[model samples]
Target: MDDHVSQAVGRPDLVRLDERLICLRFETMKVLSADAAVAHLLSTGAVRRGDTLLDSSSGIYAYALALACHRHGLRCHIVGSTTVDAAVRTQLAVLGAHLEQMPPSADLKLDQNRRVARIRALLAQDPRLHWMRQYHDEVHHLGYRSVARTVAAELGNQALTLVGGVGSGASTGALAGYLRRDAPGTRLVGVQPFGSVTFGSEHVSDPEIIIAGIGSSIPFGNVVHSRYDVVHWTGFAAALSGSVDLLRRHAVFAGLSTGAAYLAARWERRRDPGRTVVVIAADTGHRYVDTVFARHDEALPIESLAPHEVTGTDGPALPWSRTEWAGAPAPPAARVSPEDTVAPVTR
Candidate 1:
């Protein structure tokens, strides 16, 4: 990658189309100390001294929460899937948080439910254990709300179409809330992996997704009367194609969620006879380097990208199977150009 363009892409200045993407990059320009996460938890009553907090998270949030618990003199333990990367596990251990892993293979429903069940069992066994369940935690909901405020503020000067993925529905839901309160007219749209039942609907889907990351089978976010305008669905292949397009065009590397939202945003620009659609690139794709975008022989195969599992329905693949995601079929990839896939034209 050209260092000059790579450094400049984050500026949100060089990019073209849809009123320039704005992000909550306070941590990008400067590192946010653990104090920030700690303060947010303490002030929200989410954490207390001598409390034993147990939580499940993807690596990043787990790392952040562990740090916060450490700072507040709390005993923290985490339950992570065995699929958690080895490196992430090391980091969690280094952070001084006790770790436990989930069982081997099961349908994602079985996998995740088993993990949650384990957490619930552990919580039941120990009265001192405080489950830091983001699903129900208002403060957990607040993390994305704070970021949404930044997105709203940045776009204050122009009309906006908002985009992002739903993991536990917190981020997108919170952003929708903040936008409604602040930018009442801004359109808030969410992107979900096609098979993810997160905000169940048959509209705007791509192919397949399991991803263990964003997008949930269940709806998240309290509806303060229709906070979100629409939830666009994206398939895994489309998301991968989108992620590749972002790298080629905008010089931004982000995860599949980024790819999913990126394509949705471009679709908004293409389909919506409107101006200024803004999508969140969430985080750079550095972590995904080893997974989705890895070398052909080493990375997950394309067949995984396509839907694989069928539930009780009489169909090849589950008819709109919302239970779990089997990756998508990989296409014989070629040059990621604007003609092949849509992306910012700035490059």
Candidate 2:
């Protein structure tokens, strides 16, 4: 039995969608990272029980961090992004997490930037508050070690391809990083929503929402560019189709990011039938009920869609575009100097 609900929630279910495809579904994916991060901080004397943990999250991480703080006898204060819905806000409140939500903004970039600025202000005001830099810190990578072991145990020594959103790079990057220790040839495919500066799709904006929790407007320090073998930038419409199809075909009701990953994973599975492809479904579809599932009628057929292959980030961002990142460095526009990296809070 687990000590806390967060431990149970952190565990992922490995569902085989087909012979060469697997769906890694999580109730709240960030719970794994949050638990590990808080534990590490406590062990290193960086934070103590009852110390308020501060961070910015769109939705998932806010809930994950709150659960972690609750499990560890700590307090949580989240500067929520505009995408945070009422369901998440209520849970955060019940979990005793203090949430400061940003005003509505059509641009998610502005929403993210404002949240970071607010976090900085909060940190400056309260020395007791430890800023959990979920977007930038390496500690978030610690939790995926067990997950990698689980995947490795299940799949043996076969060539594998991991498909998931880059997000803060903790989920896909860290899992791949740990998996590569044994299977060095493991292929990592990153999915991104249009307009995320993390992979240089910022020039072209998605007509719909940016698909929160999967992409970023700013550079996340933990995102190691060389980790990905391929990158796919998918717009909201394509993802919606993928989500609807995934539910109809596989009964895997997941979020928009999962839909995008599923779309990318299907293509990867077809291109390389020898390698097993694993898709990361970071969260469930509850929050997306109104925004995504309700618009199922508008979803295009998944079979009719294919990514426009591109050689470089400079190419036009189509509804779906694929590029061979092949261990490339960060694009010039998204690169940051060593000093620009955000350091972990220590007291």
Candidate 3:
């Protein structure tokens, strides 16, 4: 009997939304990543029974890690984002995972910084706690190898393009890496929010931006710039409109990130009309009922722009920058060095 929680992950439904576009709904994708990471640690003897697994997350990864800890008999602690909804909080409680949520901030970047500071303090107090660095660790990338294989098996030798939010870079990057080996002609497109620092977009914090589970203000070590053939920077209005369109058009209720990916995939399909375009739907719309669906009428009127050829990694001009990395290397991991002397936070 395969009673493991990891068994409950992956094998997402691939629904054809258009003649050229398909939505790969990975509602429990993070579970596969979390479970795989935890299983690797356990098998490698890096973590033992009663050891507390700690990490910072916006929501999905937190839930995934908590479930993994429950299965492995390990303690779980999460430094959650301020925007984490009640649904996630309730689930964490049910799983017996301790959650320390950061205070409401102006933007995701500030929220993430506070969460990191909190994690560092907790790590200092208890050296036995294992910090699962999901943002920077290579082990997290291993979880998506199966996903790529599934995609390859389904598509065969068809020329495919994969689109999804950049985030920690594990899902999209790992998927791209695996697919390159399976199908060398596959193209990768990464989506990011307007104010995200990941793709070198405007660094200013926008409180209006509500898209979560993707994009980052701090440097993401996991994101391999070269893996992306193009990058899209979608704003709140664009993402909101995309989400509404998905719900209204396809009856596919998914999170804001999925909406953004759908928009990109639709644009790509319209542009080529011959290639098969696949978008990753990271999560469901259950957690985003209030912010996404409730305010659907308020979204800006979307204007589908024509897809342009990308030349280099610096990205396209203005608006939605889409550019090639030209084989640029990923940034260094943001780790605590010996010279780092920041004070620990008590609150």
Candidate 4:
């Protein structure tokens, strides 16, 4: 029934996981933004068929942009992070997208920096190429309008709370922005990994990983700090337990970021039983099988895990922490001029 595979992949399934909690699951979440961005660019004459689109991605967005390019008859050139796995690389290759993956690095900041540097270099060499600034551009936010409508229609007038990873500010941020237009009381809770600079948790590093794709080491221009009503900073161990428990209890196989969001969602629902909490599962568990699911035995009991409540960024500590964001401005580390979110002209 769809014109392109991207349409099917980008469409999410809303599944009720509990009496007051639901899961908004996606195949490859970035496909929604990629397809919409490409379509808008074509309509506005910023790009055309056979032209190349360039962007930097860690993993999810690379495959997403590749699919969008395939569907739209455009070329995709991805400056990928070291986190991009072999499976994603193969998919990108098969889809005819060009990938320049960075060398392996454990430090996320270095990996992100390397990808951005490569993108800049590529843009300098080819002014004809359009950069899909997934982390910086507001155009990416345009895609979630329909998704918000879907949520509003399906959930139907209950006091709503949306919980998801604050990735690039396009998914969770955009959805909350759209959902709030009609229902002004809709609450937005952002999930972050311990080391993400986006929400000022960078001071405390998670020993395992930052739950990649959910959190960022560098500041993302698209992240509007004021949108969040609450923020949860989760570590690798806590998120792993959440993912393992989610599969065991709810039969939902989702990624690391989803686990973090699920953990936060459960807590929020417990505190506010009257509100319906929707957790965003951005992708499936396939990519995280070896890293997270395989370590299921190491997962702790979810009932035993509770976040350390903090009033401010400095108070966040340990495996999990929660803070009342309460419409605060961007933290000092992530403060960027509003214009940074604007898409730049092709260099």
Model 4, position 312, has a per-residue lDDT of 71
RMSD of each: 12.4, 1.1, 4.1, 1.3
Question: Which residue ranges in model 2 land beyond 4 Å of their true spot?
Answer: 337-340
Better structure of 3 and 4 per lDDT: 4
Model 2 alpha-carbon miss at residue 181, Å:
0.2
| Predicted structure 3, TM vs. truth | 0.89
lDDT of 3 by residue, 1-347 (tens): 56875566544778888886888897767888888889998988888877889999999999999989989899999999998779889999999999999988866778988988898888889877888888877789888888888887877888899999988889988888999996888888888876666766644344477467778877766778878877777766677788888888899988888888877888776767778999999888888788778999976544654334455434443234455554555434322243332222211
CA lDDT of every candidate = 0.53, 0.92, 0.78, 0.91
Ten consecutive residues with minimal summed lDDT in candidate 3? 338-347
Q: Name the candidate, 3 or 4, with the larger TM-score value.
A: 4
Candidate 3 positional error at 70, Å: 1.2
lDDT of 2 by residue, 1-347 (tens): 98899999999999999999999999989999999999999999999997999999999999999999999999999999988899999999999999999999998889988998898888778767888989788999999999999999998998999999999999999999999999999999999998888888999888877888888888788899999999999999999999999999999999999999999999999999999999999999998899899999999998999999998686847699999999999987677666446664567
Could you give candidate 1's per-residue lDDT for residues 158-241 as a string of tens digits? 667777766654556666666667666777666655444444432333333465566543333322214555555556565676
Model 4 over residues 167-257: C-alpha lDDT tens digits? 8999999999999999999999999988888889888977888778888887888898899999999989999999999999999999998
Q: Backbone collision count in every prediction?
A: 14, 0, 1, 0
What TM-score against the true fold does each predicted structure earn?
0.71, 0.98, 0.89, 0.98
lDDT of 2 at 340: 45
> Considering only N, C-alpha and C atoms within 3 Å, which residue pairs clash in candidate 3?
313-324
TM-score of 4: 0.98
**Residue 268 displacement (Å), model 2:** 0.5
